[model samples]
Target: MSTQVLSPPVAAVRLEQVTKRYGSGPAAVTALRGIDLALPRGAFTAVMGPSGSGKSTFLHCAAGLDQPTSGSVWLGDTDISRLKPRALTVFRRDHVGFVFQAYNLLPALSVEQNITLPLLLAGRGADPGWLDFVTGAVGLADLRGRRPSELSGGQQQRVAIARALVTRPDAVFADEPTGALDSRTGRQVLELLRRTAEELGQTVVMVTHDPIAASYADRVLFLADGAFVGHLDRPSAQQVADHMTHLGEW
Candidate 1:
């Protein structure tokens, strides 16, 4: 008998020569300049760039919120760049998670209801045990019945995080998730996000301008003039700030 080693799993997210452009001809504005990236599962990565660096465009393209003008994007083994609009919408609902600065929650829904909304939209019944686990993971076990209006900003954001995790999505994309919180609360949220990646084996990709927020990630990738310029591993806030200073003005 012959023994063979199995290959490792595909990247949680991969982008190959991805580019984006708005308009055409002389008036065209190119956002991404052939970005290539691969992020593994159970990793926390942060993206930082100065103003007009294509950070938002990169996130949108990677998250399937917008199509790339060229190249390919893969979510695990699926070529999401080729999916049609409706199929892409369904795929994103079932496979991808999002956390935004605004804490986009439904006012009429309870915390638990909001968290399970993705599963509802997917027409899949929430597993009670899994639901319980996700709520507990985000420290919302006791506040499951509260409405969004009844919660504090931090609590509401926690609900959003729990909601993002409920689908057990392949990757969670966070756009300035701590932007609206005070320093102390923002620290708490960042810690929770790190824990989600470390303890749950989830892949997290965050885009932010704050050095302190970016420092929470395992690695910080820098962008400039629409391309990935460099990266730092396990960087400190001061290091990130100094690098940004060198990258030029915000």
Candidate 2:
């Protein structure tokens, strides 16, 4: 009998020579400039850039929230760039997780209901074990029956984080996830996000202008003029701030 071997999982996200344009001909505004990026499974990356530097555009394109004008995007070898609108919607629902600054939970729903909304929307039954695990992990075990209105900002964001992780998607895209919180509460959310990547084997890509927020990531990728300019590993807030200072008016 022959022995069989299995290869490591594919990259959680990959971008190849991707570009985005807002218009055509002379009126065109380019957002991404032939960008190539690969984010490994279970890793956490933060993207930072000055205003108008295409930080949001990069996150949108990479996470399948928006399409690029040229080049390809792959979520684990599936060419999401080529997916039709409806197919893309389904694919994103199944494979991608999102955490936004707004904490978009339903006021009428309890914490547990809000967290399981994605799975419900996808018409899938929640796994009891996974639900319990995520709720506990995010420190919401005791608040499952409470509504979002009853929680503190930090706790509400914790609910959002739990919701994002409930599906175990291939990657989570966070857009200024801490922008709306106070410093202490924001730090708590960031710590939970870091724990998600480090402990749960999930991949995350976040976009933020704050160096303190970027400091939570395993790697920091700096973008300027819609292109990758530099990167740092295990970065400090001071170092990230210094790099941004050199980039001018972010």
Candidate 3:
């Protein structure tokens, strides 16, 4: 009799013994300390930490926005940390999506233009059907002709989310995506993010300090003093808050 062995699912993003340090003298600050993480494809993960706990560093490194002083960052089968600036820029543009708190949109562009900017920059044409689906998914089909100035804050953010999904990238990195919105608006945006991962099979990594925001993710990883301290799976808001409260003890 023979038994079959199953292979583990490949990680969408992986970091192996990653470390980052600023400056080079005695005053140099270590932003990350030997981080070893593997983000599964089609899952949503949230990162949380106290101020100066290296949450930003982790995101930057993982997203290829910054390089690690020592170690490797893998985006699928590619090692992004080794790529040169120009190559890395092109690679990132083609494979990754970003959602930021500021809702960085070109005020002069129509909603459709803003959402399709990535594809245009890449010198590619948007697929009409995919564009239609994306606009419909974000509830912006009717507003596609409008500019950013004509939209509410929440509406602008919905546009940003739509733009992030326009590329059909392997992963989306969100940096405090709900910080600029009111609680209700924030919740709505969070729900949209969660739905994207659930329905479209997009991998998402978000950085947030709010437990309510973290609760929307499938898993929450806590960082402290440049290192990972703990994590919670399928966490509740209260549970996330409690874990954060004792992060120092871990």
Candidate 4:
């Protein structure tokens, strides 16, 4: 296999001419159309698009949760898209964390247990300092003993965030993390996600439909029909809304 040389600046996450198609020939539905992206270290980026615009596909491919049909995905020095299944699994377990629209916590597990699930699954125990820091950062220190059933929607999402950060991942992929919560709680979760990127020097790529949520990111990348068409830095909520609206209307 020919080696692909990655860039020297060391982006925490990136995609180069990546594409994904659901079928072959005339039946094929191209989800992504040879897109490129670079997510800098310690930055928070939001991905915005309407439904079926490949927002989720991009995030999944970047996170190694799914493979692209062609091109490359680089995580730090490694081309995660090229790793074999076991290696990819290890890389994702060791370096990548993810947040989804659903809390997806084990209902039987307490907040603390749920937070440590990934680590435990990898045959590692929790680190007290990381546990303390993430839980405290998410303002869930007192709720560790509580189960998912007992927490509010926002609180559960905070637990999910804590779980994602417990391993100090190189980067995180979050898809509609605040979608399941109300506006007030959603803002709180977004703030915590922002803090995670800023204070911890972690990279984050989030897919969000809400411009308010997108505004929390340091940069916003807008997509239409599975391509990277535009970007904005330090975008305001209004700016994000305007850009997304124009993309939809285009």
Candidate 5:
């Protein structure tokens, strides 16, 4: 009988010895150390840290929004750190999705238009079926005709979520996605994000400061002083808050 060899599954996102520095010399500041990480497919991971702990820098490098000074960032098999500016831009547009706290939507475009804008920017026509599926998934099917200005805060954020999912990208990076919403509305958004991972088998990475928000993730990775300090799996909000309190003065 021939033996069947099984290879390990490729990571949805991988960072190898990644480092980021702001300047060249004496006044330079290192934002990230030689960090390494690999996030599995369908995993919902949260990154948390105190102020100036490099959370933003980590997200920027991992999402290909910024290049690393050394090492490589891989979205699946592609080493995004090596791509030229134009190619990187194209790759980010087609393969990565982002949701920020600002809910960056065009006031003039209808909800449906905002959701499909990514495809339009990529020069690809939106597939009607897929567009409908995305809008419905985010609970915007009924509100498709309304402009961003006409929607409530929660509804607008849902539109942003729909836009991020429209591309069906390999990974979605959310930075304080619910920062602008009230606690109740924030929970709704977080639940939507959790479902995006559970039901759709999508990889999600969120950077946030709220312990309650981090509790929604499968695991929470803590960073301090430009390096990973610790992590907790399926921890309670109180547990996460206790851990954060010990990291340093807030």
Candidate 6:
């Protein structure tokens, strides 16, 4: 293990024997195959896998967006697999946040409104201090009045990130967060995500295919056939590429 792996995480997320499948018997395809992994608190972690590696399945399970076929997915102390629908929504709203390749901001809402929309839907109020911190942290203070259409792709993604951070949830799950941006813009977003974990003690788990994106993570996990094949820590893009090449996926 690298020293990065030995370093204590500020917050921790765990999965035990997590598996997911569709259909039944010969028709059933196992998306995840009893994979177990831990995401340390306040750590920026990225996941990478080839086209059909079950990476998306793992992300959905981690965020409680989809139920695993068996096993447990634990966010902090909450075993998300067991929550009822209503309870699950409440739990996710209060403890988990998300970002994706799509910005997913409402077209009609201003940046501020979009960022706080989740809290409003939960019937909860935002913490004023945390709001200030998130907007400032994402450098979106001046753009809060604008709608998604008025902003660039990078800015729209920043809003999505701000919304994800606004709740100050225990962990944030980002799937292909920078996939739509140009390389330079992607780097900016990656840097901001890292800053959120490092400066504010936010825990982040991101799923990405781009080696440059994974390099920003404190640690990186590689998936193959719905299982964790290996991991890299404090990696450079070149290093990840080299490893991926050897893994027969590059």
- The most accurate candidate by lDDT is 1
User: Please, what are the lDDT tens digits per residue for candidate 5 over residues 112-201?
Assistant: 999999999999999899888878878898999999999989999999888888888889999999999999999999999999999988
Off by over 4 Å in 4: 1-8
- Judged by lDDT against the true structure, how good is candidate 5? 0.94
What ranges in model 6 sit over 4 Å off?
1-11
Model 1 agreement with the true structure over 1-250: per-residue lDDT tens digits: 9999999879999999999999999999999999999999999999999989999999999999999999999999999999999999999998899998999999999999999999998899999999999999989999999999999899999999999999999999999999999999999999999999999999999999999999999999999989998899999999999999887642
lDDT for 66 in candidate 2 is: 97
Candidate 5 residue pairs that clash = none
| Per-prediction TM-score | 0.97, 0.95, 0.96, 0.94, 0.98, 0.94
- For model 2, the stretches where C-alpha displacement exceeds 4 angstroms are 1-9
Evaluate candidate 3 by giving its C-alpha RMSD to the native, one decimal: 1.5
Better of 2 and 3 by TM-score: 3
- Whichever of 2 and 4 has more TM-score, that candidate is 2
lDDT of each: 0.95, 0.93, 0.94, 0.91, 0.94, 0.90
RMSD of 4: 4.3
lDDT of 6: 0.90
Which residue pairs of candidate 4 clash?
A: none
TM-score: which is higher, 4 or 5? 5
Root-mean-square deviation of Cα positions for candidate 2 versus the true structure, in angstroms: 2.0
